[model samples]
Target: MSDSQLAKLPTSGMRRWQLTPKIRLTSVQATLADDLELRGEGDAHLSLVIMCEGAGWFRLNRQAIQHYCADSFWLSCASGRCQGYDFFPRHHFYHLLIVDFSPELLTLVEECGLRVPGDEPKVFSAALAEPLKAAMLEIQQGWNEASPLAALHLESLALNALWLALGQLQTQQEARPQPTASRLPSRERKRLIAARDVIRQQASEPLSIEEMARTAGLSLMAFKRGFRAMFGITPWNYVIECRLKLAQNLLEESALPLSDIALRCGFAHASHLTRFFQRQYGQPPGRYRSSCQQVRMAG
Candidate 1:
């Protein structure tokens, strides 16, 4: 088959379920009521599942069932072992199946590579349910039929499905609504919230308490007191934390130069950035990048 066609099918080794450095594809299946279990005596690979309809339960390793209902999906694999999982199928529950794209996707991180940033695995999204469900159905059908190019066909569809699922997860995280406290005085709350938004929006700028207070329409002293009471941090500390977070993202998402990263994130200079980054992350940016690059290379 052609390269494009190959992209649609599972790599030849997929059936072994040894999704190692080579696989960048996701598998599919459905879930149902009751519990599913997977037993493993070894440790390796990446796995996950999403519940499209019902709830999933687990310990630390193993899943209860392989052939489940139309539940969305669940992801499980070796991170560490001596564990398992359990799920409660709702009255009408469904889920899908997916495996790791391998830790190797870190290679796609460009010249900089995936930063040695923390791995944050969040829940899959509801918005992707329909398309992903359809893709899983196709995979199921192809498997049952034992189609000539079953792996090839599933590969492309699975890639598209995974991309859609990840896209939804990203959007959901970015769109997470900040909580508001109704019990707090509205003016104080608005002012504090407004300051928080300003810090979030202009984290790279050298923001001062006075400036943030102005944005919040509160006097500087009042803003400081209210902010501390609300957020438990002085404005300067909060701003620095915000800038550090943004810097972290830039380091992970882009191959920007250290000098540029420092300036863009409002650090006094590259050396200053290095000091803070080292203290916070326990390594300088360059070192962290190299570490991740090494991990990818080894994989």
Candidate 2:
């Protein structure tokens, strides 16, 4: 698509880019004044949505309503045809990226001997990983560069995002059990979601399992069990993940000391952050920051 065509909805803060013949990226970053409904038809393509900031409800082919939040992602495959409806509440701020891969891209992936799951229409959502989040940020930052090579740069970044997303999808499918009716009631599920949001929003604060259980309105045992069942991770581990993610972002984006980052991310001390950061990212925070600085300087 041409640049003019890409910005058809400038008033709504929506922009699109044709990274390649078979790959496209669309971004929406806006604060809603009224409830918005986005409807679209899907052909034989796969779509990956990276939600950097926002919460919304969407359904594919009139399927069950699925909720998406900031720091999460959604993936959908349309083998033949599909329809999608996304609803965003009024007065909410949102920033999200939608990357679509045409059937030709899928063919290329298959030729490369990578199986693309789901022959029929299907959708999945999960928390975004720290590395994938960082990559998406890079894509956004590079999207508007006015260089002749910007298209090539964006194409490579888009493909990298797809690769990382597909890898995460494959891992989730292999590690988790198949879908079934949820055991938790809808109200309880909403409560659990609220509690999870608390962890995401308040990772830097002092948070406890008891407080999280109270937020979910469930007993300690029930909260623990249900949280694990719903999210595939324990509450405490999710907290640590959030903290580490914040630390990683700080390490890359700021020149703050490690101890300051640890405190800002709710770790007790620099050593505590170092232990988990190394276990999760395979490097100490100092080395990670140095490497990121080197990359920035070289770039």
Candidate 3:
């Protein structure tokens, strides 16, 4: 958000109300035989509910009680007034990611190959929830696994997670029309741009395969195959190679210790730094430093 815009946000007891650059998320666990009423105006591409305990009614009107177990439900609505009560999930903790976005933003997600045809929201179970949770968790655990993790990897995993959820939604209702390969214009170029931006910003952080896929705006399999074809190396390998190259430059020029150098270069520690350096340069960092010293002497 722009500085001025951020300043407009009420800081007074609204700790729960926060915003990410592109998303806003909220959660609640209320127990009441009472019916809840919601009257508001907002637009979003998707709203997800991961119920851990308890059950409640869901609908614009208190018309239906979606008997939700330990399952996930997605309510895909663009905008206008939406209401529901006990719409309350029966679970230990009701987790949710209510994505508030413009129609244009939703189109951007669609362009990124996220939403399947006729994709909507409804309650789902382990068969459906596990993969989405797994993908999301993978994104978290591997946030910095550049060679192992990249933005594309995160995006892909997120898509897969949503896809699994959507697939379940399909079974609940009629399937949405499947988007054809043609629907998404080849976005490899945009993907590459996103990758460059992400890599440049967090050169020291690892990028997951899923993140790379997301960056490339492609599915996991498609992103892998496409990234390799475009870059002449797998995305994961390319990321490692890129970080290693940066490390070498810093090691040769900076006065930082090997431990600091490793951390700065994205390695977990000095040892990781040495291992990759030796593998790529045919010598450990100590030797490489000595060699560089010799070169400087000759110069």
Candidate 4:
């Protein structure tokens, strides 16, 4: 159906917000008197829908799926078939954030080695994980920020949400055995572990790669290669990962200011911490802390 036709659907209420030419974000808040059935247009696009607050059932094809508040669903709208949702009457309102993108967006995701699943248009029920929830909230809040940055933030958050969505699918499968890669020499391995331990222990203090190398008893180049072989990530990335994870745990468990958290996590300053935190998790430290706290309180 066209936009105008969709707006006239016999639902309680619906609204669509256009973010870009081919990208649309929608909000649906409906209080139904009966099972409200709605159908999709079967457009060739991708969609990420978050059930912010609601209880509803969606029937796509022959499958009936239930959704709760905080649940998410990813839709691949390439099939040219009608998709439907059934929302029951509720005293409280049901809210949804629907992010729709053109088929071209998948090209970008595929180039990044993160392909959204499903060939035909389908809705896979998702429970928005903590990190993804942060991204969604940031995108929502970004709407209030100034021009270019708001667009940029939405783009980043969309990609981050896609990555997390794919990751969630990966986690649903059972584990399988895989061929093991060759291991580093026993002594070299010990040295690498020792180096990692040193980094972990001194993450809150100023520590150098040279210090880590000396502790590992290897030259800098060798240390880098060996560490990558052992850890599957660069030594620098590993150091940042350690510090960030520490900072993340502290943020979740404590009520510390950014400056204090930065100092405790070995960052040069709160701004420095904010820069890397946003790079690593797509949000600043404060936003991440708030998202985590909200999740904690809800749980």
Question: Total clashing residue pairs per candidate?
Answer: 45, 0, 43, 0
Residue 39 CA displacement from its true place in model 4, Å: 3.1
List lDDT for all candidates, in order. Answer: 0.53, 0.76, 0.50, 0.64
Better of 2 and 4 by lDDT: 2
Q: How close is every model to the real structure, measured as TM-score?
A: 0.38, 0.53, 0.38, 0.47
Show pairs that collide, candidate 4: none
Candidate 3 Cα outliers beyond 4 Å, as residue runs: 1-186
lDDT per residue (tens digit) for residues 1-299 in model 1: 11232243334322223223444433332333334333224233344344344443444433233333334454332323233333344343333445455543332211111111122221222443677667656654555444447666666665665565555553453354433345458878977987788788988976655556767888665676567668866566676677778788787678899899989998878987887788778999898877777776899
lDDT of 2 by residue, 50-84 (tens): 99898778887767889978999976765576766
Evaluate model 3: give its lDDT.
0.50
> In model 1, what lDDT does residue 175 have?
56
lDDT of 2: 0.76
- Give candidates' CA RMSD values in order: 14.8, 16.9, 14.3, 15.8
Question: Order the candidates by TM-score, highest first — what do you get?
Answer: 2, 4, 1, 3
Best by TM-score: 2
